[model samples]
Target: MAIDQEILEVSSMFRLLMKKASQDWNRGACKMNLTFPQVQILYSLNNRGSLKVSELADALNLTSAAITGLTDKLCSLNYVERERATDDRRVVYVKITKEGIHAIDSVKEIYREMMEKMFNQLSKEDIQHLMRIFAQMLVNIDN
Candidate 1:
């Protein structure tokens, strides 16, 4: 196949896979009264400990306004808290609460189960290869 044709086919397959995965994830998130982005924010905060609003926005590739709105909602849910810097009141940090940590743990469990069901038919070697490919793709995208 031509290179262009190969690209088109691969991209189409990726899009379809992502669509299905997003739907499944959304369903799981709904069970916890969370949206996909809300769960993502929780996970990010869990992994990074705490971050400034701008940093979170950059990490998520979302606008500052969007991040603010999401953070507000998360705050209302008691999943996250905004703290001002003691020395620099101008800087605000977003940190996950104990409840948020618990939420993240719950979401991770759901994600693990979902992945197991999705990849049950794949051999171990195949899954490893897919992981490698995905890591490389992420590196390529970053570059």
Candidate 2:
């Protein structure tokens, strides 16, 4: 194939892979009454303890407004709580509750299962090559 044709094919395959993976993740998350973004928030809080709304937005590559909305839903579900910083009352921090930790654990299981199903056929060498390719692509995109 021509270089242009090869690039187009790779792009198309990338999109398809992302779409299918997203669909599978969404389906699993839905079973737990959560969306992918919500799960991402919980996962972040679980790992990082607590963070400000703006910080969460930056970490998730979402807008502050978007993070607020997601946190609102998570708060309603009692998965997380919003509290004002003691010394800096003006600042609000989002913390994952015990329930949030439980939820994230479940989400992690779903993620693991999905990844296994998707990549189990790949050999270790193939996985390493994929990791390198993805790393290079990210570097290129950042540039």
lDDT agreement with native, every candidate: 0.91, 0.93
Candidate 2 least-lDDT 10 residues: 28-37
Clashes of each: 0, 0
Tens-place lDDT per residue, model 2, 18-41, is 999989998999878998889989
lDDT of 1: 0.91
True-structure lDDT of candidate 2? 0.93
RMSD of 1: 2.9
TM-scores of the candidates in the order shown: 0.80, 0.90
Residue-by-residue lDDT tens digits, candidate 1, 35-116? 8788878989999999998898899999878888999989998999999999999888999999999999999998998898
Residue ranges of candidate 1 with Cα displaced over 4 Å: 1-13, 132-143
Error of 1 at 111 (Å): 0.6
What is the TM-score of candidate 1?
0.80
